[model samples]
Target: MPKPATENLIEFLSNIPFFSEVTKSSLKHLTTVLERETFRKNKLVFEKGSVGEYMYIILSGSVKVHEKNHVFGHMHAGECFGEYALIDSNKRSASITTLEETHVLKIYREHFFQLISNDIGFSQGILSVLIKRHRNIDIIQENLASSKKALELANSKLSGLIDGAMDAIIMFDEKFRILLTNPSASVLFENNDVIQRNLLLFLDESSANRIQNLIKNDLNNDQPLSSNYLPDVIKVIGSHETETLNEGTISKWGDNVTSFYTLILRNIQDRLQAEDKIEFLTSQTEYLKEEIKELTSDHGIIAEDKSMKKVLQLVNKVASTNATVLINGETGTGKELVARAIHQLSDRKDKPLIRINCGAIPTNLIESELFGHEKGAFTGATATRKGRFLLADKGTIFLDEIGELPLELQPKLLRVIQEGEFDPVGSSETIKVDVRIIAATHRDLLQHVQDKKFREDLFYRLNVFPITVPPLRDRGNDICLIADHMIAEFSRELNRPINQLSKEDKAALINYNWPGNVRELQNLIERAIIISQNNSISWQSIIPQGGIEQEATTLQTSNTIYTAPELIEIEKANIERALKRTKWKISGENGAAKLLKLPPTTLASRIKALGIERPI
Candidate 1:
């Protein structure tokens, strides 16, 4: 049927240009040795300069012939390539690739020669094809010569333009091998013989590879690249000066077949250095404020009374350790000052002491204030921020008015104090820190815990090492010491001559109940100093609501108002009243200090100063 497939193939072979006029019997023998093959679109039939051992005849579709990256010729069905292999072994002069799905008949070198020797017409046809190919090659050589001249002229102009450029310019190939460099580039590199050296040698591997890929992509896309800004420091090989804040751009140039890239670089070193100096100055200004605060605050706390002395002694012992401190006292009893004192005496004294008043921040913003937040964590959070706990890393954090902290957030606070780690608001990552905690509050935390207003677990965690600050009234003679210190400070500040306090003034201060503690005493002393025109401070100038009238009545009623024995007896009577009110418990919740509105330490000092002991 259909004259049998072999006979059909023989008939087809006899009609081809190489086998035309050969006897059908010889064509049939040739067909028997012919091997059939097929190739898809864009498939390589043979590469240039490869050893060719077989000639291929296209049976269907089309193929392209290319020399290097340039396409020069095309062939369709019934056309052959590697024809020189039939005569003698030789490398292919050009590469042949499929343009579309193609079927080919392959004739091995030995078999092709056998058929050519047996048929004179077949040999003539092979010679005719070879002659035509030689002529075509001559024409192609002429065209290539003309193109080479044009390319030379273009390269000359490009080189002249590059030499004139003030910015550093360099040309490189796809493999990142240097091709040419301008005078500016040579100076920047500190070397004249840079040709063939890889760019990776001059800069860091990552940056060099990035620049190479950037240039390669630009060349492939035939587009200009945006300038890439470098960091503060870039190391250069064989150069005395290191590059700073350098920027560069890459662009494609020259022939399409052999792509070449050019890079232009600019220096912004001076501008970057100026910006760095401004940043340093801003940080220094902030540091100066902290230093001034520390210097001034260190002088304010006095410990002349036995109660205050004991508190100071405990502070010294606790400052050497990383224990949590819970300072218990009235609002104006220098609780924060004591916290600062502990920080200043600790191992982490050089680091920052972050202070946050829990009562001062709004309820909604307290979480962000304590643990920081990422940008867009909530509305109005325009940028990422670091909280007080983060800023106090390797230092101390003073949580003032801790009793005012919201109960909902007490668990997080407790975790941070116990584990030294916390998650920021709206962030998944946990931040760990090395910090000492010092918390202060005037409210009764134990009572709040019992009332369910504060967390009991958090209260127990915070009360690890409690230190009570003494009130000014129960501090006894220390009141006069604090008065003189405040008067001297205010005199220097106000430029006044009020230096000494009268005996009646001192006695009136000792007898009157100080409702507002040390803060009130400091305020009174400052006012008296500001109003007085003379060198001496009078009792009339600083008399509380009824101090002068009461002093006069007491002086008329008693024989001696300034005697030490009578003053001790009066102090003992006051101590006895406070003890009776508290049921004689010395230092705990509902103790004498709570009843008398005094710090437990200050109340203890008053009992010792007055020589009053607990009755059996």
Candidate 2:
């Protein structure tokens, strides 16, 4: 009784489970409410979390049910999707996408409910399908939860292993864009913002070129996704433009459409430095030994005066400790001798004692001389060289003339003292050393701090144990002893028969203020020995006629004579002046302690000893 096309539609509806129990009359009525829709392949039918308003049945092609990028199931022709919409108006549990160009019959929720309510048989049949789908959904949810939990556990373990690795691990795409990086990789590159950046940005030109070639060769050869070890080391440049040698492997993964690469690297900078350090220290030690033999007397430091004995006592007390010593004295007063004594007595005596004169080096090169530089860091930096700090690792470094250290570079020295770490000039990587520091200076560092020529913090850091070497004039009778010792040595060296100094010679030497300290006495003795006649030294010839009187007059005019009590008063006054200048601040950059070039604790002790106090 129906048209041919209508009869075909009725037959299709009759075969479906929902309408199988319905009467022939109901099947004919269902065709009127069903709407036919067509979709292109890969077209989105409905997205997860969207409102569900219609139920669809595949009529010609297949459709995929997925969440995010993972496909869970597929439905071919004669299969139904969005069936839950007929029972309730909840959000879609899964997204539907056409796997191919497909035709589908869609029924609105209102029409679907009307057909179920109008016919009891159809309603029973629909309920049966709903119960079965519910059971299937429960099973799928349990399996999905188990799979999600397993995936999370696996990912966590992998992440922990990668993060805990000491070697740097990085992941990148075919274009060399960074996809992920571990903490070690971040530290090696010296950059935290490496993600989404090009890998070539962190490598030197040669390394970048080589890496590109390697990748191209592998791709061109159609090699399978596998790892390949790089035999040669690669040079990586850090954020500070410092270069380091890294050894590692590169691996490729993923299909042809989307390729990924993983780079695993280990930094070998420390190992290379260790090898170079041994050679450098061996040479440096031999050179220093020769220098020591030439400069020092056979009997070592000759001291007899009470002041010199006290200086030696202080040196002995502090030599055992790793405390930084600041030897304050005039030039030619044997400050280097005191430094050598400390190093020779310390626990680190077995290690090298490296000395660097801050003022002796040029201003432009002093930084490199202290912290070192990489090759090509600047003009003339042809080969990488270790600085004095690196060479003095586990040893003592005597920073002579520390007051002359440039103000800009003081912070780096402070970092080394405070943190035991420093970055070489023109390098980003930080190098750590376990070197003890012993600084010496003839300049008044306190005055230098007030003049803003030196860093206050650095002064405090270096002044941990202050040892003031008495000048030649202040050492009392030590001058005569040193003179006699020098005279014997110089006489022997010059092949002169002058064995001793006369009473008059001793008298003149004692009376005259030797402004040049022990060094001047040595020189005078050497000259006297060279020009002596008849195996006798003449004091009159060397002293000139009025030299002693003139020196006495000069000393008197300069008011240089001070007793122990007078000297103490003078020191107290100087500290008070600095305190008042700094508004009685005892610590910090602008504090009185810094102005006086003393540690805060030392300054406080002195203030207490001197009974000095702030204004009421």
- Please tell me which predicted candidate would have the highest TM-score against the true structure: 1
lDDT of each: 0.76, 0.82
- State each model's C-alpha RMSD to the native: 16.1, 19.4
Q: Between which residue pairs do clashes occur in model 1?
A: none
- After superposition, the stretches of candidate 1 with alpha carbons farther than 4 Å from their true spots are 1-298, 547-616
Q: 108-154, model 2: which lDDT tens digit per residue?
A: 98997898788776677667667887899999999999999999999
Number of the top-ranking candidate, with lDDT as the measure: 2
Could you tell me which residue pairs clash in candidate 2? none
Alpha-carbon error at 140 in model 1, in Å?
16
Give the per-residue Cα lDDT of candidate 1 at 384. Answer: 72
Question: C-alpha displacement of 218 in model 1, angstroms?
Answer: 8.7
Cα-based lDDT at residue 82, candidate 1? 84
